[model samples]
Target: MSTEKIPQIAFNPKKNKVLGVEIISIENLMSRNQKTDHSPEKAHVLKFNMIVLFTGGESEQLVDFVWHKVSKNTVIYLTRGQVNAFKFNKNLKGYLILFTNKYLEKQLNALPQTTTIRLLTSHLFSPKIEIPKDLFIKKYFHLFYKEFYKANETHIDTSTIHHLFVILFNKLERLKTNQLPQIKNTERFSIFLKFKELLESEYAKNRNADYYAKELHITYKHLNIICKEVVHATAKQFIDDFIILQAKRALINSTDRSSNIAYAMGFEEPTNFIKYFKKRTGYTPNAFKKIHS
Candidate 1:
């Protein structure tokens, strides 16, 4: 595969429209894709969060290279920095809601703490959430669709739209609770979130769990405990897994040479990075890239 960088779609809303939120029909998206240079079916990374609600037909979506089965009532969430590609079926019908992190931050600040926490933690797990069949709850999707389309009007009540999103998210949280392990220790979870934030910004420079622990102002043991409680992985294991994930994304998304990718990921030597990747993923960096590519 050539080393061309994957296409990255930034949040581009219409002029005078709210800077963060956009909702479009799947039909419109497909039409737009035909006119664009980038194909939705090809693997590319996103620069914003997206929620796609499939209201008809069935299909598969590639998120971070994992193909997930999706169908009616399946809502797929894609966060920023994740590699994804859409399999657009003629029968597929839904609405795609795109929101910027800045807009999400605004909503979170006004939302209930539980809503904020659930939304934040949702990114850590599976992106697909199967909404149960219920007419009343399903109406929330229509409400959001209706509310968002008003953006073209002279004045749109964004506050009302934001609240509708909060309600929609809370409903999804209820559905998710049925699928996930019970969350324990909010305080520990909070610390884990902080650790994640730091890791995202520093993983290219620091992979040591000890460094993260120190940055978070916690001992290594305490950090490990937090990691275990929240993600069922040791601190070191979590750090390594994150590094491997980033490596895989880079491998598939960039045209850079393996050595350059390794160096950019903070490895002192490309050989050590190759060995480390092989040990964790059972495939050398170039081999994995070839397979994924």
Candidate 2:
């Protein structure tokens, strides 16, 4: 069933919110889509999680500038504020699950911090997972999808949705843990996750490790300890890596001037930004763009 056609999609943003979750397909959402650029017009940073489960056909999703394959049994996961775009086949068949942070955070809080919860929250982990398409897999989505629409016909039973959500999460955990073992449940892991959440929201303005440590009510030394224990890196290195990644994403995806990109990224001078980028990446912003563009 493999084809040689390259993935393509043109996108204009649309508000795709439902009561809590929006399950859709590219075929159904074609109005906001098009085919031309292998890339999106610009990078997309969503405020919610977008999960695409490919059941048929072939395509690619440009997630944070990495083109991930979308074929049978492939799943793409995009976390909030992570860049993504559709470079995809028109013939592809898949279910796209979009749900808000509020919805996901609320649900996870009600459950224990199991492997499933870790997979759902860890943003640095791989964003795509491929699993076999079988009844066990189909059952999870079917129950959730059926209950979602049935509630629309009758009445919304939040519990029904949550029950199905738990089952589906476990299935996904199995796939993720196979690739990356579940992180231990410890104070360090908890601290690292909290720091990560804060960084995702605050990385743009507050790049200092001390700022994050203060916000998390932990010492900077303690934060470094937690980060090294979990990710094998220092807290400051993690923050800088995130900043550089966002900068690179802006440089490669947008046509804005380098100075503009630097200013938007909170640098007072373009020279400093350039130096910082080159120091971390060994290439000037323009040079990096030359390779990507």
Candidate 3:
């Protein structure tokens, strides 16, 4: 058997639908797999944002190559560029809300500035939010489903859907904050967020902490202090972890060979890349690919 390269799934609105948002039941989505040709069981990199709320069933979902146990009230937030694959079981019942980054950004920009909104925009934190029988979440999802797919509507009222989406994110943000209290330091977190934005775009070209510090307009020591305060890792360690994660994602998600991946990731010599990977992960690139493949 051979593995397929993880696809880059883009957000394409359906016919006559102007809104970038779509909500569908898991059962309906799985049933259309054959016609749609995009099975949930396979891994793919997303080009948009997604929120999957599992209202029933027990299964594991793969996010960024790691499997997470999910059950009732488990909400998974998958942002753009993350690798995602769903384990669809017959008994699983849920709702998937898919939207474009542009749609989400526009709604976010219209909202007031707050820590919760900031956290929702920043992708530096965990993506899972487990709500234990929360009534508000249940009601919100129910209401959203009714409005999103209501019959007799000539066109979808995107404004209403956007408001529901904001409410959902705010609730998820509260839960995430409780799970990660260190993000409460608004000042440090703001700087750290900027650092992360820079790292995401420039990690392939530059892995040096000094470069990021210069881009953030802060001294190296100051950047390190902020990194430690927010994520409990030094600036350099954070950069290494991020790049290694990107490497791991590429290794498993793509069919590219180690040497090819090394060159794409800015390594001049594949041998040096192999050595660096081994030092950080205790496994050669080929070995890691074998284990994860």
Candidate 1 backbone collisions, by pair: 3-255
Model 1 C-alpha lDDT per residue in residues 11-39, reported as the tens digit of each score: 88653355588878787888888888888
Q: What is the lDDT of residue 197 in candidate 1?
A: 86
**Cα lDDT tens digits for candidate 2, 133-218:** 56366556656666766643656577877777766766776677665533565777778778888997887687899999999998
Q: List the pairs of residues colliding in candidate 2.
A: 8-88, 10-34
In angstroms, the error of model 2 at 132 is 3.8
**Tens-digit lDDT track of model 3 for 1-293:** 23566678888755335577888888887797778666767777888888899988999888887788899899998888888888888889888888886677677754445534443444456678888684469778878888987898877777788899888867776677664645656888789878888898998799899999999889999999998887788999999888888898888778888899999998989998999899999999889877655
TM-scores for candidates 1 onward, in order: 0.86, 0.69, 0.85
Off by over 4 Å in 3: 1-3, 13-16, 109-123, 180-187, 214-219, 252-255, 290-293
Assess each prediction's global lDDT (C-alpha) against the native. Answer: 0.82, 0.70, 0.80
lDDT, model 3, position 28 = 84
TM-score computed on alpha carbons, candidate 1: 0.86
